[model samples]
Target: MSQIASTDWYRAGAHGIDIRVRLTPKGGRDALDGIVALADGTSVLAARVRSAPEKGAANAALEKLVAGALGVARATVAVASGHKARLKTVHVDGDARELSGALTALAESIGTRPN
Candidate 1:
């Protein structure tokens, strides 16, 4: 679970943190499974969406999901990149430390205790 908070996935951006997420569209439900490590040592939040990867529904769901997880306004979250790919970068605008704390809590909820 240490990989979830790894610097390799999220970075402090000009306005906020840019988090890498690997979304599974058409998943049975809208949920966050935890962190997943790529073959190349990259880590991403493993998220699932009930919406299909069409007409941007899945992207919207992902934004909402991430916003909820971060305890921020839905409008503050955006799909920064990878709109057409499973792997996406989500841009969240808010207090960086507060957001990080929220993410830490989320990680704990999923049984990934931060060190």
Candidate 2:
């Protein structure tokens, strides 16, 4: 099993992950925005969304898009803040480094890299 599987982070009801996400919200032709990468052990994945924040639709879409991409259930994701802003929080369940690396790859594909 992956380290994420061994840690309590995935234990449900305990040890949540933080990702720094960046939303793109119509970067051009892309239907949805890309998820920006944050450091590990953070709940700010910096996920970018192509949908505008209209009546909480963007936020919901973001949750689905991000959770799908991360291979986690939507229950694992939530907007800790920035409901009307571009940046938001993404809670995950997994190992810090593993999750971070996955997000970094996703971000890189969209021409963004984590620091």
Task: Name the candidate that leads on lDDT.
Answer: 1
Q: Model 1: clashing residue pairs?
A: none
- Over 11-92, each residue of candidate 2 has an lDDT whose tens digit, in order, gives 2224555654556565432233333233453222334556666898777777788677767779867866677777665567
Off by over 4 Å in 1: 1-5, 112-115
Q: Specify the poorest-scoring 10-residue window by lDDT in model 2.
A: 1-10
Clashes of 1: 0
The lowest-lDDT stretch of 10 consecutive residues in candidate 1 is 106-115
Model 2 misplacement above 4 A: 1-14, 26-47, 94-98, 104-115
Query: What value of lDDT does candidate 1 attain over all alpha carbons?
Result: 0.82
TM-score of predicted structure 1:
0.88
- Give the per-residue lDDT of model 1 (tens digit) for 1-115: 4435545567775688888989999999999887667777777788999999999999999999998877889999999999999899999998887777777777668643232
For all predicted structures, in order, the TM-scores are 0.88, 0.56
Candidate 2 positional error at 26, Å: 4.7
